[model samples]
Target: MCQWLASNPNELHLVNRMDEVGSSKSVNFDGARKMALKQIEEFLLSFSDPHIFSEAATSSAPATLAQVVEAVRIPEAGNLICSAAAIGKYVSMLQNPSSLLRACAAFAFVQFTLPGGQHAMHHAGLLQNAGASPVLRASAEAATARIESKMYARIVLRNLEHLQSSPSTQF
Candidate 1:
C-alpha cells in the first residue's frame, strides 16, 4: 500500500523538479539518430537526381546535405516519396532537435501535398489526421529551426488552409 502511494505520478514530478535536479537541461537528439534522417534525405534526393546520388551521397559529405532544404518539386516524385516514407511520419518529425532534419521533413511534406501530386488528397488527409497544421505553425515559430525549414512549414500550412477553404476540385 505504501509503495503504491510512493510510486504515484505526483511523486515522480517531485523527483524531476528543477530545483532538485539543479537545471532542466534540454536534450538534442542529433547523434546516431541523425543517420536515419540523413538516409531519408538521400532517398528523397534520389527521385530528382538518381545518377548523382552515388556512393558519395552515402558518405557524410556536407555539400549534398546543403541541397536538401529545397523540396523536390517534381509532380511525379510525390507518390514515389510516399512509397519511401509516410506523410504522418514527417509531420511528427517537425519537432526534432536537428534543424536540418526538420528542414528535410518539412520539404518532404511540401512535395507530398503539392497541387499536382498523385496522392495529394490522400496525403493531405493523412496530414490532417496527424494534426499537421498546428505542428507546422509551431515549427515556423521555432527559434531553433532553420529559416528554410520555417519557410517550408509556412508554405505547407498555407496549402492546408487553402485546401480547407476551397471546393473539392483541387488541393
Candidate 2:
C-alpha cells in the first residue's frame, strides 16, 4: 500500500477514505495505518521538491498534504521540521494571480501552523515580510492566534505591525 501510495500520491483520497472506515471499533487497521503513515513520511522526505505543497499541481494535493501534516507523529517532529518550514515558504503563493492557487497556499500555511507544527516559529518571519499578500497576512494572523503561544504570537504580531506601517512594501 505504501509503495503504491508513494508511486501515486494523488490517490491519497482513497487511503483517507479507508482510514475513516477503519476507525470503527470492530476494525483493526492499526498496523495498516502505521504503515501508511510511515510511507507518507518516506514519500515526503524522498520528494526532491518540498514545493509540492505550494504548487498544488493536482486538485487533491492540498488536502493530501494536509493529511500528511496531521499524520506527523510527535517523536519524528524534529526530523520533519525542515520540510514543514519549506512548505511554509509557499505562503507567498497567497499573492498568486489565481484565487484557487492562493487559497491552496493559504491552506498549506494554516496546516503548518497547527498544533504539533514544528518550525512554525521560523515560518512566522516569512509571513510577516513585505512580500506577503493580504491573504497571507490574514492566514498568518489566524495561525498565530491558533498557536496560542504567547512568545510566537508576539513575534508574528510585531512583524505584522512592521509590514502594515511600511506602505512602500510590495507583495
Candidate 3:
C-alpha cells in the first residue's frame, strides 16, 4: 500500500489520506521491515550511479521539480564530494540527538534553497517526510520562505506571517 502510494504521482493529490494511512500503527512489523528493505534496495538500483549525486547537486544546469525531490530523498549525493574531515564532522554531529535534529533542519534548508536557486522551477514539488522533528519542519518552512520570496515579495511576506503563527508541518 505504502510502496504503491510512494511511487505513484497520483497519490500526491491524496496527501491527507496518505498521511492518515501512514500514521496508522502497523500490524505487521516484520512485513514492514521487509518492505522498507526492499524499497531501499530498489532506490539504490534506481540511480544510475551513486557518484552522480554530488555531480547533480553541484551542476549549474537547471533541474526539474522531479530532480529536486529526488535529491532530497537521497542526500548521499551531497556527501560525495565532501572531504573526509567533513564526513567525520557530520558523523560526530549526528552522534548527539539534539544536533541530529538541528542537522535535519539545516539539511531541509539547503535542500529547498539550493535546488530552486541553483537549479530552476524546482519549487513545484513539495518536500516529503514520513516523520520529522519540529526543528526540521521549521527549517523546511524557512527554506520555502526563502524560495517563494525569490519569486514573489507578497508571498514571501505572507508566508513569513504564516510560518510565525503556525506550528504545523507540511509533507
Candidate 4:
C-alpha cells in the first residue's frame, strides 16, 4: 500500500500540495492539511521497523530507495529528511551494500543541500563517514555538476571530499 502510493506521481503531487497548505496560515485548508499530514505520517512510520526493506515481499530495495528519494525531492517535504527517525533510516540504508541504495541516499543528500534545506544539513556528516561508498561519491559528483546553484554545488562537493585528500577529488 505504501509502495503503491509512493510510486504514484499524482499522489506525490497531492502530498506536496498538502505540505504547502499545512504550513500556510489559511484556516480554511487546515482540515485538509491535517488529513494529508496524517496519511504521510502513516506512510513514514512504515519505515520505523529497522528491517522494512528485508521484510517487504513485494518491493525491492532500489524501489524503496527511489520512493525515499522522491519524498525528499519534494520541496515542501524537506522536513521529512531532517526527522531523527527518518534520518536514521536513511543513514542505515546509505550503508547498504546495494549501489543503487547508496546512489539514492546521495541524491537525497543533494536535495537536502539545496536552498531551503538547511534543516536537513544536520545529517551532512553521515556523507563523510568512513563507510562512504564509491557509488555515493559518484552520485555526489554528478549532483554537484548538475546543480545550478553554485553555493549548493560547492557545499555538496565539499561534503563529499571532507576527509579525502583534495588531489583525489580533482576532476
Candidate 5:
C-alpha cells in the first residue's frame, strides 16, 4: 500500500482502503488504480509523440518490432489512448532511467490535446513525412497536388479522418 501510494502520490487519499497489514485487495483499490491509470494515460497522451513512434516503426528496424509497433496506432479511434498505451509499453521496455528522461525531453517539443494546448491536428504531425514505395508515393502526390506526398501520408490522412469521426472518442 505504501509503495503504491509512493508511486502514486495523487492516490494517497485512497490509502485507507488498505488492510491491517498495509496490503489492499485489488478490488478495494480499483478506484484509485483506475484514477492512476487515467492520469498516466492523460499524461502520456499530452507528452509522448505518436509521430516518433510511427516513424521509428517504419524505419529500417527489425521486422518483429516493426510489426508490433506499426500496429500500435488505434484503429477507428482518434483519442490519445493509443499513444498513451504505446508510451507506457515503451517506458516499460527501457533499461535505464536516462532513456526515459531523453524520451520525455524529446516530447517537450511536440504539442498535444489539453487545456491551452496548440496541437489541433495531431495527425498532421504524424504524417509530416511518410516513407512509401515510389509508385504509391507518385499516386498520392498526383491526387493531392503535393508532389512529395507518400503512401504513408495518404494512409495517415485517411486514418485521421476515420478517427475524427469515430464515435468512441471523448476528446
Candidate 6:
C-alpha cells in the first residue's frame, strides 16, 4: 500500500501529509512545516557526522532512512528542503565515505525534486547552486558505485536536466 501510494503521483503528496496529520500539533501550517523540515534536515545531516554515532550501533539506519525517504515526497517538503544549508548537508552526504549514504542522498533527491513535483524547479536551482550536479554526475559515472546508487544519481540528474530546459522554470 505504501509503495503503491508513492508510485502514484496523485497519492505521492499524501505519504508525507498523512504522517504529518497524524503527528500534527495545534500549529499553523507554516510553523508545522518549519518544524517538520528542521527535524528531517537534522536527521539527514546526522548521517554525515561520524562522531555522532558509533558504526556498530547504527544497524537500523537503513530502515530509518527508508521512513525519512517516504516522509518527504511532497512538494511542500521540497520547498522547505531546497534551502542552501539543507542542500549543502545533503551534498555532504553525497560525498560521505559510505556508498550507502551517497545512494540514500541521491534517492532523497529523486523524491524531493521529482520532475512533476511543484517545487522541482526551485529545488533544482538550489541543488545546482550548491554544486550537487558534479557530485551527482561523478556518482552516476563512477564504476565503483553500486548499480543502484548510480541509477538513483542518474535519475536525479535527469530530473534536474528536464527541469532546467522547462520553460516554466525561472532562475
Ranking under lDDT, best-scoring first? 6, 1, 4, 2, 5, 3
Q: What is the lDDT of residue 47 in candidate 3?
A: 35
lDDT score for candidate 6 against the true structure: 0.59
Ranking by TM-score: 1, 6, 4, 2, 5, 3
Deviating ranges (above 4 Å) for candidate 5: 1-27, 60-171
**Stretches of model 6 off by over 4 angstroms after superposition:** 1-80
Count: clashes, candidate 1: 0
lDDT of 5 by residue, 58-156 (tens): 453445333422433322222332233333332232211222222221122121212122332443323222221232334334433221122233343
Any residue pairs clashing in model 2, and if so which? none
lDDT of each: 0.55, 0.40, 0.32, 0.42, 0.32, 0.59
Which should have the higher TM-score, number 3 or number 5? 5
Give one digit per residue, the lDDT tens place, for model 1 in 99-136.
Answer: 76577677767666665566667667677877788889
What tens-digit string does per-residue lDDT give for candidate 6 at 1-171?
Answer: 224223322222322454457568763455654564454445444434332223312333544433333443444444333566666666776776556556656766776677667667878988988989999999978777744456557667877888999888886
TM-score of each: 0.56, 0.31, 0.24, 0.32, 0.24, 0.54
Give the lDDT of residue 70 in candidate 1: 38
- lDDT, model 2: 0.40
**Ten contiguous residues minimizing lDDT sum, candidate 6:** 4-13
Candidate 4: tens digits of C-alpha lDDT, residues 31-134: 77457556644543443333432332234344553443333354643453354444444445344443333333444454554434444344454444434344
Of 2 and 5, the candidate ranking higher by TM-score: 2
Lowest lDDT block of 10, candidate 5: 105-114
Error of 4 at 49 (Å): 33
lDDT, residue 83, model 4? 42
How do the residues 21-105 of candidate 3 rate in per-residue lDDT, one tens digit apiece?
6568553345553454455345334432335444443453434323434544434322223223332332232222332222322
